[model samples]
Target: MRLLILGGTVFLGRAVARLARASGHHVTCAARGVSGEPVAGARFVQVDRDHPAGLSALDGERFDAVVDVTRRPSHARHAVAALADRVGHWSYVSTCSVYADNATPGQRADTAKLTVPAPVEVDNPVGEHADFYGPCKVSCEDAVRDGVGPERAFICRAGLIVGPEDPSDRFPYWVARLARGGEVLAPGTPDDRVQLVDVDDLAQWLLYAAENGLAGTFDGMSAALSRSRFLAEVAAGVGRPDPELTWVEQDFLLARDVRPWTGERSLPLWLPLPEYGGFLARDVTDSLAAGLRIRPIAQTAARTLEWIRASPGDVKAGGLEPAQEAEVLREWAARQ
Candidate 1:
């Protein structure tokens, strides 16, 4: 199989290229070449997707499959316009954030209501316009499906993707914290739900869809797990199975100004309950049934820790510093 990845220098795209190469598929990665380097085995084509003619370098090229992981609607539209006719299968990596109702759990991709697509003027979503991220993806999904038609388009609505080479701090924070081994400050209740897909697992599924010509929309993540199990598996994976975890109430944490998800003074992957109950607890039964294989969290955690150790400077830093955690824990204990 001949595979072409549109943005192959970064996380998920790189994973897909690497896996495709290893699977004996001839892989070609087309990118701006500024983010990161593509895997050693795949062919690299330096092309800018920001302009309409940027992809003209590959004028007569064709591929068995093309995987595009672009947040910009313009990029998606340009790729589809340039290569939709020649590519055998088109896979667009989208996010679960496109769903309009995040408070309701167990919503399937086919039945869920999607947010409004970005307006025609908004090309890039950044900083103050961050909320446009999901909507832009919706526009991108629309372009792919409309360009290639549903029979040849695979739309993957991915959840929180975590594993080795992850550019986010959400999952890696737990791996590093657990490896430290001490009185760790855990957020929310132990029963709070969590969901994520390993990068390799997601990449494999994308390849499977391309190889088998699977079409239609589906969430891309593992089955949801309790927060306690999530942390325990991570700890065990990092060789700290018995760390002391102090589960703090959500109200207390929020009152103390501790942020949720990723960022400074934040507990990564810890979102406020009820409001975001469905965000991390998506029903991926259809995804699983459609060849999305999920490995154990322990395995994902251990591999992530190894990657962090090898590339310490590459991991993005945005979690509770030890002192902030200690201070929050101290406050919580006092309230208790």
Candidate 2:
């Protein structure tokens, strides 16, 4: 099979490209070539996808399948328009964030309402403006569907994708921090639910689905795990089981100005709001039925820790600093 992968130089895209090549598919990776080397065993083609003729390099080419890993709607729109005629199948790597409300549990792939007021143009959706990310993706999914027809497209509404070479560092932070063996600051309750898909698993599934002509939306995720169990698994993966976890109340953490998710002062994977109760517990029944498989959580954690150990420079980029966590812990202990 011949495959074309958009944005294959980093993370999930890189994984897909590598796996496709390993499966004996001839792979072409289209990107600007600025984000380091392309995956091994794949041909490289430079295309910005933001510019008018960015996809011109592959204008006359054809492929058995095209996997688009770009986040921008405009790029999806253009890529579909450019390759729709030549590609046999289209697989889009979308996000579960497209769901307008995860406040309700058991939200199915097709039943969940997508974010509205979709972005008309592309821009970096960050910080308080991150709401735009979902809407933009919603638009992208629609564009892909409209361009290639829904029957020819496979839309993967993915959850938090974590593993080795993860640029986000959300899961890696917990794996690396807990290995340090200390009174770690834990947010919310031990039973708080969390869900994430391993990058390799997701990459493999996307390729398999596309090659097999599977269509429609599927949540790319794993079974949920309680906070305590999740941490324990991470400890086991990192070979550190002695860390004294001090589970802190969510309200207290909020009052003390501890933020949720990523950043220097935030606790990754800790959402304290009532509206987010179902956020990490999305229903993946359809995904599982469609042959989506999740690798063991311990394996994901161990692989992530190994990557962080190898590339130690930026391990602390999106996590709490040691001193800040210590100060928060001290203050919380005093209140008790």
Candidate 3:
């Protein structure tokens, strides 16, 4: 099927575009000539995705599916409105952050919390500060649903999406820190629950939904496990010392108000994972029920570390000096 993906040059967007093409689907990607070049074998549209008006370039272009990974809902609302009548399916990349609850896990679309205070105009100005990021995306989701209905549109609300080309230093920070191999300055307890979806898995599942023209919103959780075990697996992946939890106690960091990872390591596990500014969100029952699942959590995190080890440059971009990292590796090894 012919698929048009907006904002398909970076991060989650890039991953989705690549995965779709690899699966033998015709993929057309659009971005503002920023961050990436066109992927081989896929059509690339170099237009400013932030500008809803730019979308007019594709006025009557027909496609079987459209994948929107843009953060601004206004642009999405505009593009969808323009193309909704022509497209067979709309796969929106929503976030689990829309849920304002943290008390428990297993969040479904029918959950009590509805993402209120929806953005008034989905095609508002370009800057993110005023546009829909999380709450804004919630509004966009509603607009898409209203315009196309559930049967024609699918929302893939994802948890922490981690893997290669991860710009946010959140997950990579752990990989780099663990690669250092010493007493890693880790926050929170091992028992603290952690969840992150691998990029490949998320992109693949998206194609699965799009291909079948599946309706309804779905949560996207790759795997869930305690933080400590999470670190252990990462250690194995990078050939680094397992992050020995200094066990500084969550209270110590809390007392000092150390808000690393946007309190992802310490916040009530079920609440949206905010470290990546709400990218790695939580409680995605809808995502799972909609048929988006993943490999084991241990392997997922391990694969992340393994990937980082293969590419030292990527991790460095996510953190500070390489020399300091060497020192860290030394400490981690000496202890073992």
Per-model tally of clashing residue pairs: 0, 0, 14
lDDT of the candidates, in the order given: 0.93, 0.86, 0.68
Sort by lDDT, best first.
Answer: 1, 2, 3
Candidate 1, residue 232: Cα displacement in angstroms equals 0.7
Model 1: ten consecutive residues of lowest lDDT: 120-129
Candidate 3 wrong stretches, greater than 4 Å: 49-52, 119-132, 262-286, 297-336
Best by TM-score: 1
- Residue 135 in candidate 3 has what lDDT? 78
Q: lDDT tens string, model 2, 181-248?
A: 78899999988899889999999899889888999988999878888988988888888865689999
**Deviation of model 1 at 288, angstroms:** 0.4
* Per-residue C-alpha lDDT of model 1 across residues 14-53, encoded as one tens digit per residue: 9999999899999999999999999999999999988898
What ordering of candidates by TM-score runs from best to worst? 1, 2, 3
What tens digits encode model 3's per-residue C-alpha lDDT throughout 1-336? 899988778777788788888888898887777677667788887776465587777777899998887666677777778889989889898877677664445545565385564545444424655534567778778878888888888887777778777766667776666767656655455566677887878988888888888888777775467777777877766666455656444444444433445323322222223333233325565566667767654565577776677776755343324454345445545655
Return the lDDT, model 3, position 132: 41
Candidate 1 segments exceeding 4 Å error: none
RMSD in angstroms, all models? 0.8, 1.6, 5.1
Name the runs in model 2 displaced over 4 angstroms: 121-129, 314-316
RMSD of 3: 5.1
